[model samples]
Target: MKILVCIKQVPDMESRFRPNGEKTWYDESDLAFRMNEYDEYAVEQAVQLKEQLGGEPEITVLSIGPERTVEAIKKALAMGGDRAVHIRDDRYYQKDPWQIASMIASYAKGEGFDLIFTGMQSQDRGSAQVGVIVAELLGVSCATTLVGFSYDGGTITVKRELEGGIKGVAKLKLPALVTCQLGLNTPRYPTLPNIMKAKKKEIASLTAAELTGEAELTATAAIYPPAKKGGGLVLEGEIGAQVDRLMGILKEKTAVLR
Candidate 1:
C-alpha cells in the first residue's frame, strides 16, 4: 500500500505571538516552530497502519512551507515515514486553501497512492478545508475528523466526530482520504536510533510552481489581536447594598435593564 501523510509546521501554541509590520500574519521571528499537534496523530496512525500491514506500506510524509519546514518533515520520517516530499514555498502563508490543495493534488495525481492522511485542521489556519479539497480534486472518497479507524486491505471503516458529541461511521474503498482527529491514536516519540535513521532518509524537494499553476483564490485582509476590554468592577458591602448598586449600574448602562 502507498500512503501519503500531509503535515505542516506551525508556531508552538505556547509561544507568545505578535503581528508583523504589515499585519497580514503573525511575525515569525523569535517564535519556535513545531509540527502541528493534530498532524502528529495522523503520522502515528499511518505508522501504526504500516506496522499492522507488516511494513509493506510505503509511507511518504509531505509538507508545504518555507525551508524551515524540513524539520517538521524529518520528525515525521523519524516516527516511521519511509521518505518525504517538501513543497518549498516561502510565501505559503499567502496561498489559500484551494491553491494548497491544488498543489498536493497535482503532485499526487499519477502517483497511484492508495490512501492519504491529514490532520483535521492546521493549528495556524484551522480552516479544515485543505484535505477535503484535495480529495475533491483527486476524485476520491473522503472522511474528516476521524476518531477511530479500521482497514481490511481494500476498504477502510472510520468513526467520525460530529457536532454535539455525536459519532458517524463511514466506509470508503481504496484510494481514499481521511483527516485524523485528536485521540484517534497516541503519537510515539522517536527514539534515538530512529532519529539518527531519519537523518539519512531522502527528502525530495519541489517548488510549488512545479506542481501546480493555480492562483490564489483568497487574500488576507488583516490580522491583529483582539481589542482590550476595561477592567472589571467590584461591588463591596452588604448583600442588599451590593444588589442595589448592581441594579442601579445595570439600569444606567443597559437599555434591557430599563
Candidate 2:
C-alpha cells in the first residue's frame, strides 16, 4: 500500500498575535511554527496503518510552506513516514486553499498513491476544503473528518464524525482521500534514534511554479477583526413605548412572527 499525508506548519496556538499595520494579517516576526494540530492525527493514522500492514506500506508526507516549515516535515518523517516532499515558498503568504490543493494534486497525481490523508482543517485558515478539493482534482473518492478507518479486500471503510453526535460510516474504493479528525488516534513522539534517522533521510523540494499551471481561483480582498458584539438593549421609556420599540427592533431583525 502507498499512502500520502498532507500537513501544514502553523503558528503556535499559545503565542500572542497582533495584526499588521494594514490589519490584513499578523506580524510573524516573533511567531513560532509547528505542525498543524489536526494533521498530526493524520500522520499518526498513516503510520499506524503502515505498521499494521507491515509489508513496506510506503508512507510519504507532503507540506507547503516557507523554509522554516521543513521542521514539521522532518517530524513527520521521524514519526515513520518513508519519505517527504516539501513545497517551499518564502514569498508566498496568501491563503488560497484551491491553489494549494491544485499544486499538491499536480505533483501527487503521477505518484499513484493508494490513499491520501489530510487534516480536516488547517489551524490557521480552518477552511476544511483542501483535502476534498485535492480529491476532486485527482478524480478520486473522498471522505472527511474520519475518526475511524480500516482496509480490507481493497476497500477502505471509515467512520466520520458528523453533527449531532452522529457517526457516518462510508466504504470507499482504493485510491481515495480522507481528512483526519481529532480523537482518531494519538500521535507518537519520534524517538531519539528515529529523529536522528530522519535527519539523514532525503526531502525532495519543489516550487509552486513547477507543480501548478493555472492561476488561483480567488484572491484576498481585505481582512480585519470582526466587530465587537453590542451589549443587550436597555429600555428607558413607558411600558407601551418600550413594547413598541421592542416590536420595531424585532421586526428590523426579522425575528417577529409575520
Candidate 1 achieves a global lDDT of: 0.94
Q: Per-candidate RMSD vs. true structure?
A: 5.8, 7.9
lDDT of 1 by residue, 70-159 (tens): 999999999999999999999888899999999999989999889999999999889999999999999999999999999995999999
Q: Which 10-residue span in candidate 1 carries the lowest summed lDDT?
A: 225-234
Candidates in order have lDDT scores of 0.94, 0.89
Off by over 4 Å in 2: 21-24, 230-258
Q: What residue pairs clash in candidate 1, if any at all?
A: none
Candidate 2 lDDT score at position 211 = 79
Pairs of residues at least 3 apart in sequence or in different chains that clash in candidate 2 = none
Candidate 2, residues 1-258: lDDT per residue as tens digits?
Answer: 889999999999888877766665667889999999999999998998888787479998999988898999999999999889999876455748888898889989999999999999988778899999999999999999988989887898999999998999999998899999999889999999999999988899998778776676777666665676986888997999999998888888885544
Clashes of each: 0, 0
Q: Which stretches of candidate 1 lie over 4 Å from their true place?
A: 231-258
TM-score of each: 0.88, 0.85
